[model samples]
Target: MKLGEGVEAAIHCAATLASVAGNSTMPGAALAESFGLSPSYLLKHLNQLTAARILESVPGPAGGYRLARAAERITLLDIVLAIEGREPAFRCGEIRRNGPVKLDASAYIKPCGVNAAMLWAESAYRAVLAETRLSDIVAEYAAEGDPRAFAASCAFVERHQRPQKSNPTKQTPARS
Candidate 1:
């Protein structure tokens, strides 16, 4: 099954956030520029992440985005769920019971094998992502990523981002 563009963006964005000093913050504008994405499109996924409690939004100057929890505590599945949602990728129409060669409704009492298999695949996909966290990715970057590009991405966020003050009130910032 194909994942949406937002899923990939959220994953990369979260990985970039993990690399920032103190697990700091970066605004949607900087994040879009860093990835060469459109601000409005990127903001859609960012808002989804915020709504899912995967990322916290900060408003005004010295405002940006930050992870709601530790990178190690945040899994790829968390981002996937944030962006793509918890719905199963496959939507079976129960075609097995209907068609030109229609089967009797009573005879179709058994669960549809095709639907079951699709659901199993989606579950397996989620299981793999759930086991892989952002910190797991940061470790992989030194070996798998381009050093210059990776360093530049982190530096850009650091130069532009403003870390939120540690106020218990602001600590649990509202969705923006």
Candidate 2:
């Protein structure tokens, strides 16, 4: 069950977004930079996440991306499905029907054992991902990940996150 590289990028981006402060967003460029990924390559997956409602995209200078809901509500499975689509990793082509020992369609009344086993494995794999929330990943990293790496990520987000204006109409007086 080989998942695409996009899945990794999407998960990391989501985990990063979970760290941003209230109403703040991290640009796709920043996300790409953080992971040393091409912005254009990452954008495709980001857009997919947006389409899945896993992440929200805000337009303009004060806009970028943020989780559509709380991290606790977003699961690894959601991101995987968004990036990889809902298709099962193992597709059964029914090779048994193609061989020279071609059996009648009626002979194959039961499902392919290999396909059934693969589906069973996939179900277990998906179950684990569904149980893992974005918040859980963030929390685990914060608690047990390398200190320097954690600090660097925090600093990067601090430097790049764009906080939404509390009141767009309100202006503070300029000071010299």
RMSD of each candidate relative to the true structure: 3.4, 5.7
Reference-based TM-score of each model: 0.89, 0.93
- How many clashes does each candidate structure show, in the order listed? 0, 0
RMSD of 1: 3.4
Kindly list the per-residue Cα lDDT of model 2 for residues 29-81, writing each as its tens digit: 99999999999999999999999998889899889998888888889999999
- Clashing pairs for model 1 are none
lDDT of 1 by residue, 95-122 (tens): 7777788767898788889999989988
Q: Name the regions of candidate 1 deviating beyond 4 angstroms.
A: 168-176
Global local distance difference test of model 1: 0.80
